[model samples]
Target: MSRVPFYLLVGVLLVAGIAVTIYRHVAFEVPWVPGEQRQVWEVEAQVNFIAEGESAKVNLALPSNQEGFRILTENTGSSGFGLSFLDDDKGRRAQWATREAKGSQQLYYSVQLLVAPNAAQPRVEPPPPDQDVSWARPYDTAAKEVIDQAYRRSSDAFTFSRELARAFSGDRQDENARLLLTQFDRPTLLVKLLNQAGVSARKIHGLLLEDGRRRQSLTTWIQVFDADNDWVIINPTSGEQGRPDNLLLWEAGDQAALEVQGGRDSKVTFSMLQHNEPASVAVRNQLANDTLLNFSIHSLPLEEQSLFKTILLIPIGALVVVLLRVLIGIKTSGTFMPVLIALAFIQTTLFTGLAGFLLVVAVGLVIRNYLSYLNLLLVARVSAVIITVIAIISIFSVVAYRMGLNAGLTITFFPMIILSWTIERMSILWEEEGPKEVLIQGGGSLLTAVLAYLAMNNPWIRHITFNFLGVQLILMAFILLLGNYTGYRLLELRRFKPITED
Candidate 1:
C-alpha cells in the first residue's frame, strides 16, 4: 500500500480501537485494566404473609434512590396478587392486594446494586427543619446535665457526637451513661440527646452491605450535624464516628421499612448475594442487566473464553519481539522462532520451559557437531538432529518423571522441529562466525523469548487482550508504525558513537 493509505489505515485502526475501549469503559463500565475490584450485590426483600377468611392487602416498603449505591434494576415476583408502588412522605412502598381469600401469599422486591464512586461518602442530607428539642422534668433535667457535661468535654459537634456515642455505648463508666442506657436504647437516647443539644439528629435505619447475608434486619444509627454544619454519621453500636463502610441507609423517621395492613400475620426478610468482579466487568455487567452481554467475551462459552484468553495474547508476544529486534538491535536464531518458543514457555511455565529448551538444544548441538564430520546432506543432517532432539526429550521426560517433577511431561509441546533447526543454525554459526558470535546471538534470542513470555503472561495484559479484542487492532497499528522506521536502534547507537566522535 502507498504510504498515505498505510498510515491512514493505522490511524483508523488506532482510533477505532481506542474509541471502542472508551465506549465500553464509560457506557458499560467494563474495566480496561486487570485486577480492579468492584462489588455488585443482588438484594431481595421478601414479604410473606398469611391470609385467611377474606382478602388481604400488604404494603411493603421498597428501597429507592439512596446514596452509596445505584439500583441498576428492580423486579417483583408475586404468585397471585396485584402490585403497585407509591411514593409518599413516609417512604417508597409497594402495595399488594387480592380480592379473594388465600392461604399464604408471598411477594418479592429485588434490586441489583451498583456501588457508586462516592458510595463511601456519608449519605447525609440536611436534617428536618425545626427546633422543638425542649425536654420534660427530671428526665429533662438529667438530659441537660448529660448534654452539658458532654458538650464541655467536646471541642466541636463531631467530637461532641462521638463523645455522646461513646457514653451511650457504655465504654466509659460514668453516672450519666448509666442513667441514659437504663432509660432507652443507644439509638433512641442518642437522637434525643443530639436534638436536645441543638444539633439536627435523626434515627435512620440502614443495612450493612455484605455478601450472602440472609434474613438480616436493618441496623439503626444516628445522623447529626457536625462543626461545619455538615451532617456526620455515628454508629450507636460501635460508638465510632462517620458512616460505616458499605452501609446503605434504608429509611429515616419513625416508620419501619415494612408496614402491613389488612393481613393477619406479616413478615419481611432480606437476602443478599455479593459478587466480586473486576471493576470494569462488574460495573458493565450490572448496567447491562442481561445474561448475554453485548460485545463482551462473557457471552462466549467457558471453553471458548478460555481458548480465546491464550489466543489473543499472541499479538502482544509478537509486539515484544518487534521492539527488541527493531528498537534494541537484538539478534536471534530466526524470525518469530523465539515467539513460538515463548508460547511453549507459557504452557510449561518459564523455568521448566527454558530448562527443557536449553537441554534439548545443548544435546542436539553436541550431536550435530558430530554429524558434521560425516559430510551428510543438509536434509539428512537436519533429520538426524530432529531424531536426536526427540530422544533427548524422551530421556529427560523419563528422568523427570522418576525424579517426581511433573513439569517434564509438558516438554512434548516444545516444538522439536524448531529445536532441530535452531541447533543446525547455531552449529553453522559456531563454525563460520566462531563460538563467540554464536553465543551472543543465541543469548540475545533467549533474552528476547523470556521478555516476550513475561509480557504475554502478565495478568493485565492477558485480561486486556482477551476482554477487549479491539486492543489487538491497537497492537497491529503499533507494529505497522514500527515497521516503517529506518532510524538507528538503541544498541546501534553505542556501536556508532565512536564513528560520530571521530
Candidate 2:
C-alpha cells in the first residue's frame, strides 16, 4: 500500500479513538434543588460599657415570634453577665449583660433552631439608618486618623471630595461626592472615618461574585442606613476623598462579622472523629470513598499517572513532527530538536517564550562560531558554548533585575543544553549543506516547534489524555501508520516531477 494512504488511515483511526474516549468519560448532572434544606439563623448581641464603674446592659435583638420560635427562658450569671432568652415562633433571642469595661465588648452566642415551613415575619428595630453602626470601630483607631490626615492634606474641597468618593465609594471621578472620602490608604480606614461622620460603615470581606479569586486585601466599604433609603453602600477607596457611591445600600449593612458572630459563642469548636476502623486500608477503597475525585487521582503512583497522561500526547506530537519533516520535506538539525523545542515552548508560552529561545540560540551560535576560530575540539567546543550560554543568561538576569522586570527570572528555565546542541548542529549544517540548507532546516525546526506547541496545548488533546487511559491505543495506531509513510514529501514534489512525467 502507498505510504500516504497508510499514514492517512492511521491519522483517521487515532482521531476516532480520541472521539470515543471523550464520549465515554463525559459527566452528566441533573439540576435539582433539595427539598429539605438547612437555614441559617442570625443572632447578634452587643455589650457596650460606658467606661464607668456601673452595670453594662447587653442589647439582644431577636427576630420576633412573628418570625417564629418562642422565648424559652431568661437567666443571669456571675460570669460578669446577665442573660435574657426571648423566643417567638421564628427563632430564639438571647440578651446578655456585662459590667463596665475599658473598651466596647462584643459577645456572640448562637442556638440551633428548627426551620418552619412558613415565611419569617419581620422584626422592628431602631429603623434601618440607626442600625448602620461601624463594625470595625474597635479594631483600630489609627484607621480614622489616616482619613483625617488625607482630608487635611487634600488641595481643595472638590479634590478632597473626589478623593473621598474614590476612597469610600470608588467613584473618585464624581465631582460632588469625591470630597467626602479622601486620602485613606485602606477601606478599613475609610469605614472608620465614615463612622465618625455619623455614617454607619464596616469592613466587608467576601468573594465578589464577578470574580472567584479572594482579594489579597480587604474590600472595605461603608454601609449607611438612611431612614428614607434604607442601607446604602459607600466605597471610600473608589474615589479621591471618601465620597459616597450614590448612597449605595446593602440589605444587612455589609457587616458579615456581626452575622457570623450572631450564631454562637466567641469561640466554637467542631470535631469529627471516627475510631475502631481497620488500620490496613486498601488504595482502591480510599479512592472510591474520596470526596474530591480530581485530587484523589494524584494519589495514584506519580510515574504511572504522568506516563499515562503524557505518553499518548508524546506519540501524537512526534508523529506530527515526523510527518512534517519526512513528508513535507521540512529540514531540521536533528529528528527530535523540534520536539524538544516544542516541549520547552510549553513552559514559556507561545510568542515570548519562543522568541526568547530563538534569541538565545542565535546568540549561542554566534559565540560558538567565534570559538571555532580557536580550533577547539568537539567536546571542548560544546562545553565552551554551554558555559557561554550560562554566562549570557546571568548577564540577562542582572540586566532584568536592574530594569525591575521580575519576568526575567523565567529565563533560568530555558534549556541551555538544547541551545548548545542546536548551535553545533546548525554550525555543522552550515558548513556541509551551506546557508540555504541550514536555513531550510532551521525554518523547519521552528515550524515543527510551533506545530508541536499548538498540538500539545490543544484543549481537546489535553482533555482526552487526562480523562481516559484508552487514548494510548489511538496514539499507537497513529505511530504504526506513520512508521510506514514512504511517499515523496510536499517539499520534494517539484524535485520529483520529472520522474513522474516518464
RMSD of each: 10.0, 21.8
Alpha carbon deviation, residue 64, candidate 1 (Å) = 11
For each candidate, give its TM-score against the true structure: 0.59, 0.43
Candidate 1, residues 1-502, lDDT tens digits: the string is: 5599998999999998888777666545567677788777788888877777577777766665555676667899987778898887666777888787566667898988877655334344556534676655556777877788879889887788888787655457376667667767888888888877777777778888778899988888887776456776788877688776588767765466766565667788888998865675555445344432247676668898788878788898899989999998899998888888998999999999999988888888899999999999999999999999989999999999999999998998798888889999999999999999999989998999999999999988887787676788899999999998899999888887889999
lDDT of 2 by residue, 145-206 (tens): 43555577565433443345453343323332233234334565555455554444444332
Clashing pairs in 1: 30-280, 31-280
lDDT of 1: 0.80
**Cα-based lDDT for every prediction:** 0.80, 0.52
Model 2, CA-based lDDT: 0.52
Q: How many backbone clashes does candidate 1 have?
A: 2
- Over 4 Å off, model 1: 51-112, 116-268, 271-294, 371-384, 494-498
